[model samples]
Target: MNVVLSAVSGISASLGEDAVVGITIVILVFLFSMQRFGTDKVGLSFAPILILWFALISGIGLYNLVKHDIGVLRAFNPKCIYDYFKRNGFKQGWLSLGGIFLCITGSEAMFADLGHFNVRAIQISFSSVVFPAIVIAYIGEAAFLRKFPDKASNTFYACVPGHLYWPTFVIAILASIIASQSMVSGAFSIISQAQNLGCFPKVKVVHTSTKHKGQVYIPDINYMLMIACILVSAAFKTSTKMSHAYGIAVVCDMTITTFLVCFIMLVIWKKNIWLVALFLPFGCIELLYLSSQMTKFTKGGFVPLVLAFFLTALMGIWHYVQKERYMFELNNKISVESLGKLVNKENINRMPGIGVLYSELVQGIPPIFSHFIANIPSIHSVVVFVSIKAIPIATVALEERFLFRRMEPRGHNIFCCVLRHGYRDVLGDHEEFEFQLVHYLKEFITQETIMHEAEATTTTVEQITSIHIHTNENEVAHISHGYTIDDTLTKEGKHSSNGSSSGSITMLRVANSYSLSSSHMEGVEKEIKFIEKAMEKGVVHMLGEAEVVANPKSSIFNKIVINYVYSFLRKNFRQVDKVMAIPHNRLLKVGMTYEI
Candidate 1:
């Protein structure tokens, strides 16, 4: 909406404000649809050259365009606006307000593109290229419009002579296409993030390229958008009609961000009440301006609301179900423990190894720790990691040595790893992190002269056994909505026997039978309490969605041990549910796992 407002307000003199505002719809469509391509192809290949081309060509025309209007500067003054408004009256004001819908549509682009192109890069691009160009064009257009109002047609196409019109239109179209590329790319990035956090469901994801995390392709989103573009174009008949649909999505999205920010302020930042009070009321004013747009709802605002609401609701549901499933699985796995009982058990205290409990959320108490302690009653002397990280993609570099220390609290053998990103950065090694870990660990542990058990006089040494309980691009922990080609065929029940799909994802049911890991040390029930306490310790980091799959070699389990544990684990891993998006249609069954 800001884009549209800026364009219209600035260009109204030459293009006729309505013309610029109208052009924004097509430009927006152009921007959102062409985003699936890799950025090097888009930005490096097209953006730099094209942006340069835009400047070169536009710059060439700037002298002539600006020559007509010495008085164009009047529009920029606050005082001139008061005179123009007195002349035009409230009808013009309301029309301007109505048209302002064009500006707010892409508001989600900010949050959706938060991680991409770097925040600095986006800010720079906006401030440098987009902003200045718009200013020049609007000023030039205003001069043209004021000189010969006939040239200021509401349609950009109508402004040019018959011969030059097509060429100008074509150039304009090309510009629109480039803009679409930016937006669509942004949508893919946002949806991917949402999917990672269970704000959305599974889609066939195509990483746009190896290097750029921002360039992603969701076949579902693409197709949905394609259809939506067509439908919107046809139904609205003009950009003006579609303009009405704009504010709903943008406003609703902003509202969500506002609420989420509030939560962050309270829970994450722990800010003072007065500070929250100061800024929130101001933000509310912005929110109200966006919300007031809903008055145009019947005109065409319902579409985006429906689109975004379905998205929000689907995300909310996925979050709910995923949380529910985690609880259910956890309940079955963890055994209750009393610290006093565990400390007294002489043969069952502590273990010589590392215990890294991996989970999507990593609840403070997990079932497996006590279960391990109960069976391995003699297991003690262990270093427990309670990781607080999300999977899918955002992984901090391992070299970030600062992170490991950030997790350590009050100094104990237990070192916490509060990695900020998904699985990759947490699982992989970073140079700085390795150096920091070596120095910090050595310093912290070296003083404790004895190792392992007390009788021998040596301390127990434990390797940092880091495992990534992965959340796929869909952001699911375990395999609640997945299936491999093998499983798909088998589930098909012998009709298409022995067929193999190379692209299929065979999700092993995690909480059910197949995905469960059964081996445990013996006679360690006495130390169980400490392990349970350690389960949620900040050291055990994890990601929301990851590629750390079940051992592929577990084909042995696929055959021989397919009975009890394997089936239970596999139950959690199966892709039994899928939610189609864009238009929000429910196609597959709620728990129907699919292959490919």
Candidate 2:
């Protein structure tokens, strides 16, 4: 077994230092470019070419079979594996076991290209082309080993006639380079998911070029992986050595997935052991077996483990920051008395104006929304909108209707809308979504009425009418419309919760994009200008869109900047009163109440 591993590593290394360099360069360049060419083209161009490469590999192995002299059948011997293990003892036995797990370096490809191929297509491709190629390539190497007892360089190349050896080596390098594309694409998909869940910082993703939702690009992740792969490929200088770094992350992720799968089943499926056992154990055993085979941690397997820590730490910090923000909002409430006095002193006149403030939070509904509603009690309506992230491609069965059932209840005379996007869509847009929602509610609302129904399927939950008004984009002339994403949505992909847009309420929405700190201010000026214009038109009750910094440092930092800018501006312009708060955080939620 040790002899075989040494031979394998020697063969891969003999491809030369330049070949590994060539492979890494090929990998990164092709990887970034793949986002544009897409999955179908990759399949179109590479699939057939890979088939030819496999055929040539097999032919070389079969030709060498006739010349084999040292126990020709040893090439076909399973007993040799047992005998080698028995002689080498347990420590060396485990070393032999390590050789088998290298096959999974490309396992991420299965997940990365999941968008390109349905489960069935990938199964078929693996069974027909990929599976056979792996088997024959090993067998071809084994056949050559029987023919030549002690060749130091690649047996696969030496087995070829002298004229074809270098050419075949070149072919082998190209195959390894192409294999790196799968890893690059896989990293893109993982980081994108992290961004959507708010577990990682937002990175730009491109979606329009491919039908494959998994096809994406993250500039940071791309650069990071490129540097890491090059360093390892150079340090180890062989796929066989880098193989250790590759499989550790794969095994741990597999273990994590298995556990997550179990949790999803137990909690989501009500702890149905039979279904969990029946469906999960097979995969569980396979990954565990792979992990056991990957026991060579000191030999380079620790690379992926190191990476896992970084990811976990990043997500942990993000969640902690958010929890701190909620603590502030839940504890603070603005005053209606001061807000009411401000609205009246301004001496504004309009029929009735309303603004719906949207926040991408599940908790700590901003106090501003409530302050405005309470203060101006007579100025039309105000809505506090909270958005929820969606779960894509949920297999809840098409016949299984009733997509979501929101059991929690609050908000009297309020409007709430649940928005979900497709799996393919990665971006979330709140302000533009408000216009569509306002247009939707206008269809059911009446002029003098103040009641409306969101969905009228259940007789008991009838419609509640509200005032007739449209939140038009033209009202805020200079603010640019937000961006929309192409997500393959479930019933509740992107969510927006709308409460009443009543009175001269300060519907303050804190925490807009770019930075949780000062970046929130990037959109604030535009928001403020919009509010100011409404005020000039005799429609100024109070409405605002601001960001709540999740971290205390950020919150203090941002609020200080905003207060400084705000105080200077107010003294230069006009002074107002009162503030509001609404729920906005990880889960799509918000609450209405005034903050003083």
Candidate 3:
């Protein structure tokens, strides 16, 4: 942002420093205000402009390289770097690296944007367009600098031909804005991911594009980034100092990414140790760059450090408290048997509707459910424990997304469902999710009934024939709704040799006898009808509102974080119901306190 203002002031003699600052603030406000339109819309409009900008710069660089000293390309040689350090001394060269590092400052934005675009798209764009354009532009600038050393401070504008100066200036301004926009979008992506992973406080994340799941906009993050940029631009008031701050942040980011990649390679991928060890040299290079940027700490590098410290601390506190809260829930979770006993012994009223209990637990019942039941002495006729889980993948297949398990003591009509979504998956609205949930629930019940009937028939056949019949239980269990005795028996039973036809006929007759009873179909239909009736009564989304407090035995610091900082954040941030997109009319808040 400071760079944009500097470029503007460079082209306009009338605009003073204060005027430049005002223009920058206005530009930032406008830029951030436009974020609600979403990254896809913004990217669509900006893409052509950026492409043109890159092409223009590339053309200018090629022209300069051809017209001026081509020998400047020799700077690419390692010998030139070694000679420079040898001549200028290590101290000056080390400090100069701070400026050199600025060239790669915006590269981290690509990594941050991986959620928005596919790996192939990013790689193709960078390798074919961005990389070549940058290299040509840099070499062109160097050639122009070699001819007129005095213009080194502003090589970009100085290299532009006199006739195209104003046009180039306009393009430069737009390009800078687009660059900053990418960084802003990247911030939103990072924060949203962190929040999903329970590392950050819940914030309102609006899906901007219906077609692209990752195109999201966070009003809070946008405005915060805008204000921070404006303040930094105003405070620094010059590009040179901002460059120092920018270099440190970029290098630190690169170093962290390197470490993360190494971990993924060694642990997650289980790569050969030698192959993973190769990244150590690259890591060392990043550390060196980081160390060089540290020399500018007093100049401006401390800015990012301070911001990083605060953000890291905030995330740490939130994540720690969340983990503690999860542990408390896990430890105190109520068993299905216990819940059944409680309800039966207490004579708890079974309400008409289907109650969808939202929880973080995938297996056992959450403590909040028991708490709600104990307090109200009632529960919905058909209770569904729904836990939304985020898996570490791009997107899960729709068919494989929801896993349903019937809670034991089938009379309770309780079911546990886990909806697994990948990190980049977009959750549908309440109505769509509710529809899918109901469909899956009915399907689950149907399959379970058929499996039970099949097992019974298999037992009866064994008893009558006194002959062992081998069948794949899993094959029978997973049969679709169009249940047929022929299909089920064909896939399930293995007939004996001597009485093969007889055994097959016998098994078929026995299966037919069971099917003739219509018990399986009746049971399935009964459950389906019950669920439909419950739906008519309405589906209630029960969300737990956990009041987290630090344990009394905790240290002062823990108390301050949990009872004060974490509590404040939880209260202020968007609620879980809103994040989950639960319908307000159907939402039920179940309050529970956790001393963790």
Model 3: residues with Cα > 4 Å off, grouped in runs: 2-9, 45-47, 62-77, 116-128, 207-213, 270-278, 390-403, 419-443, 459-516, 519-539, 580-586
Among these predictions, the greatest TM-score belongs to 3
Each candidate structure's count of clashing pairs: 94, 70, 0
User: Can you tell me which runs of candidate 1 are displaced by over 4 Å?
Assistant: 1-37, 56-67, 100-113, 150-155, 158-167, 251-292, 334-456, 460-596
Over 28-72, each residue of candidate 1 has an lDDT whose tens digit, in order, gives: 555555555555555665565558645744553364366777577
lDDT, candidate 3, equals 0.77
Query: Where does the lowest 10-residue lDDT sum fall in candidate 1?
Result: 587-596
Rank by lDDT, descending? 3, 2, 1
How much RMSD separates candidate 3 from the native structure?
8.3
Residue 220 lDDT in model 1? 68
Of 1 and 3, the candidate ahead on lDDT is: 3
Pairs that collide in candidate 3 are none
The residue-by-residue lDDT of candidate 2 on 464-484, one tens digit each, is: 222212234243222111111
How do all models score by TM-score?
Answer: 0.53, 0.60, 0.81
